[model samples]
Target: MAKTKTQTATPAPHTRTRTHRALLAAQLSNSVGDGAFYVTSALYFSRIVGLSAPQIGAGLAVAWGIGSLAGVPLGHLADRRGPRGSAVLLALATSAAVASFLLIRSFVPFLLAAALYATAQSGLAAARQALLAGLVEPGARVGMLARLQATLNAGLAVGAALGGLALSLGTRRAYLAVFALDALGFLVCALLLRGLPPLPGAPAASGDEPRLVVLRDRPYAVLTLLNALLLLRLPLLSLALPLWIVQRTSAPGWTVSALFVLNTGAVMLFQVRAARSVTGLPEATRAVGRSGLVMLASCAVFALTAVGLGPWPTVAVLVLGAVLQVVAEMRHSAGSWQIGFALAPADRIGQYQGFYGTGVPLARTLGPLLVTTLLIGWGVPGWLVLGAVFLVAGLVTGPAVRWAEHVRSRAAAPAAGELVKAN
Candidate 1:
């Protein structure tokens, strides 16, 4: 008599627990480095590396574009090989890429290094998501992701302060030190990943299963696009709001930094709580819908700042808007995690997550231009349109998710019947 699946899986509670902690620790370590790198990279390139602003911008844009295309194949590699090893290798590659930046004195070297860094970061993200899916129970993945988000925010805050210190020093040595710190962080991330239990590679694809099944997944692709639209919020605070505050509103210059601090602090404190109630697809969709409404309200509040308010009044309005935006950000993040994980096939989690993760780079690439144009060039009406976009995307998520679920279920039915017949 053979045992059922549960009967054969009773001894790994402790291992799972350790894997969870390891994932959180790894996220914190790398995110801190990313924070410092993001804050100082432009200055380092211009002041120390002798690169023009346009050159640096072009290099990174091209790098992330290449990275977006690389994610699917690399994710497929993770699925065919093993996520742990893939993740470890990619982390090391990322560290190497960052180190290369320190030595790059020309445009070509910077471009190559930046591309490698982007590709490795993209692949590492996909592999880690797959690893998390393998190690954690399906029901708990969202909560775990929320905790990771909180940890990431906390780490980034600390790293940002360190970056600020380096910026104030404004020396060649200080800039080099920040880059070195980023390299070291990724190195540490690689080591932490190496310690995790190795998961088996996914079984070989059958003749019917295409190597890149995710590419053929239309419903999942639709959801991915919709999620990408929502992710336009990525540049809202960083690019749009700052410009809005500086050019349009009467808020003090420091209000921009204050708003950023408010957003990060709010996420660190409340993200897990925001995610706690979102346990399934229905809840996830609802959370997203609610977030859109809140985001719309926040947009309205931000628009009010343009009406010739006093400095304190403008600051107050900005803070209120920032608070609302962060709340929406937290909820949208939680819901998107649940949807991305739930829609993916268990065996193809790596490739699926990799494809899903493209939304980030897509947002990064297109979001600044789109957000700045809408929020700054178009002004109040633009805010309304942006809010409407969020609202529509959130509203449509439920139907899109249902479509994906239906397709996935339909695809699974034949396999289920085949299993039953064999048994």
Candidate 2:
């Protein structure tokens, strides 16, 4: 007694296309409001709440580290149970954390709220990405991912602008309002996900696959490791770069906020075309490699900002660095997502997403400490060190990409399929 491929399969077209779009829109809304909180929170705590910059950075690093450890099990849970449930819980947790800002203005309470928010961020990211994979046609995943990222950056720009506006309002109440808006965004995102048709959970099929099986896939494994380094450079830019500008270049806090606005605004404008440029590329591995190169170049720009440029020149350098960072972010996000979707079994997307997502949060945990420490000890020289680390890490991962190319080539040869869209 034999089984047909179709009969043995779980299902085709697990959810409708519009459902995916709804999820993406919700994500964009959440990111726009949430993004502002991170950049501004550090500043607010340091300048307004009366903490030292180093102390604030250290606290964030510790909170992020704790959240990263928590994410693994949460990811696994999303895989076993369902992301819809997780998404709802995430929304609730975020709401509570944001509201807690009003009641407990101390450092310890802030740390607890930050940790909770980070955990929610990790869970939502994994669940949303995995859910999208289930809902979309496989060939369109990269484009969808880019669109998702572009939406997020756009939302971030809006959020940052609003936060800046709140600062101008000059009251604790305004700040609390901003946090409340962010919480509401999370709630909206959860509601949107809940309305979508059921996405397949990891346990329903291929229940025998162990978590470690993903690690055996060397190409993916290697890329995940390299991403750990890439993720570090961004926070350096987000947290450290602005601080550097304000302290060293005679710029105000507004100047730093303006620079971020430029960074995110550029992504919103150019991300679509950049995403399309590699869409028909031959191999996913090379596409991802190209993304690495873009990132390497951007890190160089960021490292040079500490050399004491005049105000406009400083802004220009910051803009250039931001441009490269966003470009690289767009490309890397697309390619990495493509890789995740391609490597995942149709049945267990949640588990794979959980494993894959560990890189970004883990990088966040480590990057701030490294960049802050370097900045304290050596200023501009520290950024050079950071840039070098990213460049070397990216180059070292090339061999694994080559492996992926070889594997994909074999898979495509027999079917003579059109090349999958490049990320």
Candidate 3:
């Protein structure tokens, strides 16, 4: 599980170019599969798989709750080994897990696959981020991450459309295809990084220390909490959206595909421009706050669909809400990028990412249950609650960003040569 540690002379111009191309290609493939899989799962579970909305909600909660716990161990592995090895192994395992879905059709086995998939996903993502940190020139880090996000968005746009089209073939078959594509993407990623220069990180940092020691960092904790809140809303798109389309809207299933298509398009178009405009941590937080306001506004629109709006109008409202939510997601993604890269200790990037990732899954676990309960009881009220959560997230994130800035300034100001590590 160790990486090749051989270092050559500084990477030549052609070498950097080749590596960048390889990484981009791999990312595009991977994200296409990711987008396809998520949308396909939503359609399959809600429509063909015979799971009720609440059951799907519960499954998502359990799967992500398990994922939250799995992050620590996965992080330790990545830190102990190297990013390349971790990413490759996890990618292969994920492929197997996805393939298993074809064999096992019951709830328990499907749940097991979900947990395994989440674990593998966390590992691959952490390794990939770490690898980027390891491989790119320091000056290029910001652009590199931004470019990666943008590329992911592009893949998402294409994947969603393709997955939607596959749905016409039949749910089980479509999902199988999604998994196959994901498997192929991982294989490509593994091949591209296998022989590249090894990532250099700081010495091993133990994660077994008291949780409080890490938790006491108020800013990081707040950031984590807010992220969790944001992730909680994911079911809106993942579960709620498809359900709404089939049960409520007269729009064809094709419309569901179109919504995702638009979401990814927004992300691809706005991400780089958005990142460029917001240059620092505080700025990014403010942007998230503003997007939260937009999300808050959009929720009312979604709620209206349940209020007897015609199919066309409901479809329009749904699209508007999705667009607003994606904008907020873009803001959150940008801020997360800055927080994760800046706050993580040089030697313990995987652990820090693991920590950050835990919050999102934890939030997702709770959100589905809470929202589902509301959906059962209050209907449109549930949608409103999601909007409220985002509002709170935005408000809380503002102070968290300020606190991080304060800590960073105080630590780095007095010591000129040293790196200021946020725990």
Error of 3 at 342 (Å): 1.6
Winning model by TM-score? 1
lDDT of 2 by residue, 148-234 (tens): 777888788778778878777867777777777888887787788788667545543345645535556667667678767767766
List pairs with backbone clashes in candidate 3: none
TM-scores for every predicted model: 0.96, 0.80, 0.81
> Which candidate has the top score in lDDT?
1
Give per-residue CA lDDT, model 3, range 260-320, as digits (tens): 6677677778777667655666666777787677777777777777766777877787888
Evaluation by TM-score, superior candidate among 1 and 3: 1
Candidate 1 lDDT tens digits, 198-316: 77777767666589989999988988888888888889988799999999998899998998899889888999999999999999999888888888888889999989989998898
Candidate 2: regions farther than 4 A off:
1-17, 43-55, 105-108, 204-219, 246-255, 277-282, 299-318, 373-376, 379-384, 402-423
What are the Cα lDDT values of the candidates? 0.88, 0.67, 0.70
Instruction: Give the Cα error of residue 298 in candidate 1, in Å.
Output: 1.5
Name the weakest run of 10 consecutive residues (lDDT summed) in model 2: 1-10
Q: Model 2: clashing residue pairs?
A: 32-155, 279-422
lDDT of 3 at 10: 53
Best-to-worst order by lDDT is 1, 3, 2
Once fitted onto the true fold, the runs of candidate 1 whose alpha carbons sit more than 4 angstroms away are: 1-13
lDDT (0-100) at residue 77 of candidate 1? Answer: 90
